[model samples]
Target: MNWNSPIPLQAQTLNSLPSIMESHEPLLSLKQYSPEIEVYPAYYREGLSGAIDDCLLRHGVAQRLKKAAELLPAGIRLVLLDGYRPIAVQQALYDRQRNHLLEQGWTESEEMYAELHRFVARPTVDPAKPPRHFTGGAVDLTLTGPNGWLNMGTPFDDFSERAATRYYEQKSDLQPDEQLIRDHRRLLYHVMNQVGFTNYSDEWWHFDFGNQAWAILTGNERACYGGVVPQASN
Candidate 1:
């Protein structure tokens, strides 16, 4: 989505965006990286059939996941939901969400669309500038351990405050069962951060390694990923 929307970045990440945008890294697919890290390409492939090829990512993104997978506590596997989305797919998702918002009569306005994109990126047509997913450095995923799906409270695209990473962090007016959800979220937070990836505060299942968001977040001078076409650009 939008690189600097809801997720507040550290000072380092904030300073790296300009440089990160200048880099031209190549894209790499996760298909052959490691069998332990399972992938579900085009989980929301509703309107995008011939448009997408596979759930590819930057070589560095795959490498980070490889290391993150290895560091996962016993009886756990990193579950990749979707990766390497084309701008067409990004536009479709944004439009779909925006339409749903409008249908619900949520005050249609240009500002409303920006608000709508707080959860999803507005697809920028400029190939030189791509949304986080288009860069192939971002991924939507969740954790699965021996106990089964590590519930992070709300499901993967639940556009609500309950989806925030810090939502469960605070102990305000919480139910007894919610603590477990909070704990699981905390675990993922720690594990992912330890591996050098940044989480979009709005979406618990979403994480980026070296995209513009990641660069801005982690303070890297330049991002390691660029827009990824299904084949060449990364």
Candidate 2:
């Protein structure tokens, strides 16, 4: 059976898991640090027309990104798919995922939690608890070069555990007809890891800095990009 399909049943519940689980610590928090480095020019390119960019985080993040760019080979440049997602957008993403599962025939009782858990790191019944993008600390990105978008071994926002597996291994799951797709998947993971950022075990493109999960991973206390505030007119 296609597991993604909805089937009516009680929701899978987590009983013993701690309310607060530890992961890696964060690299920095905007609350404490005034971004010491220069922001990047390309980030202001109006790609994120609808989302938030509070504290000018797009600029601050650009600094770190510049460093990452230097570490890459001469041809590669980072292509940011998303950044500073608002809480509304986050809710939309969650709702879209849940609704798709329900349409497939999954019951709210059994499928709701499992569907969420599959994609989100810490799936909670409460709609209020969203991923770090809600806090503006998270971003979804990939790499590109003169050849065009580099193959990241998976599509953006692929909500499958297999996406997190090593690229070479992930290739085995593809149909016999799609070998090139598999190679791209592996290449993407390798390049992303070469930089300091870490991928969500479930999402090949999702990465964060200031959220609780990111803090735990990077050993930070506060999160960056609390929310978006409009820039003053000069």
Candidate 3:
């Protein structure tokens, strides 16, 4: 099966979708389930403002991650880079991405924001249109094998064109390194997707469940989850 298709809906269109906000799931720690999967909180390690040391996800989302891990090939592990981001962290990420684009010579304009928002969502307080990470329904993750993190063409949070989930898939003549990256991406995408997660086309490491993105991609009229309240990290 080809896992290289572009996401039908764009990032900017996610907020416009209707969500009923039915889920009241509690956030759960990934640590309690550690060794089954690894938690490496990226923002926290980077010391971003309001970052949390503990990795977290909604109850159902965590369950799905566990299931996904169980299905991975032996010696391969799913590393959770981030989950359940606070509003402050989201804002920090947004600002950082914006500044980076500006440094790259992108003028401050609607086009610049459109590009920035493709990978980093603008922070929001509204429950109905929460950023994906803020909902505990989106997760940023990658795969690690016996040696270490599998090469996925680009590093996490790389906003370049190469970061697109299907970038490698669209390539015709594959070099050995490119082939390796494509296979690794395919493995991660299929495993998480098998457990009902939807990959954000712009980021190979990002996936969604129960949020507006997932609902829209899966053709559900209502999302089961909305913005989860940001809690004090343990």
Which of the numbered candidates is closest to the native, going by highest lDDT? 3
RMSD of each: 5.3, 9.9, 3.0
Cα lDDT of all candidates, in order? Answer: 0.73, 0.50, 0.86
lDDT string, candidate 1, 101-140, tens digits: 9888888788888779788887874554568998888988
With a 3 Å backbone cut-off (N, CA, C), the pairs that clash in candidate 1 are 12-219, 13-216, 13-217, 13-219, 20-223
lDDT score for candidate 3 against the true structure:
0.86
The most accurate candidate by TM-score is: 3
Which residue pairs of candidate 3 clash? none
lDDT string for model 3 (54-173, tens) is 788999999999999988889999999999988889999999998999999999899999998898898997867889998889999999988999999999998789998888878799
Q: In model 3, how large is the Cα lDDT of residue 1?
A: 38
Cα TM-score per model: 0.83, 0.60, 0.91
Please, what are the lDDT tens digits per residue for candidate 2 over residues 1-234? Answer: 221122122233322221223222333333233332222223234443343332223444544545555655567666666655544555556676787778878887855777676674342324234455544456666667788877666666676655663444434566653455455444444554445444565666666554444545544443343444334699
Model 1 misplacement above 4 A: 1-17, 21-25, 42-54, 230-234
List the candidate numbers ranked by TM-score, top first.
3, 1, 2
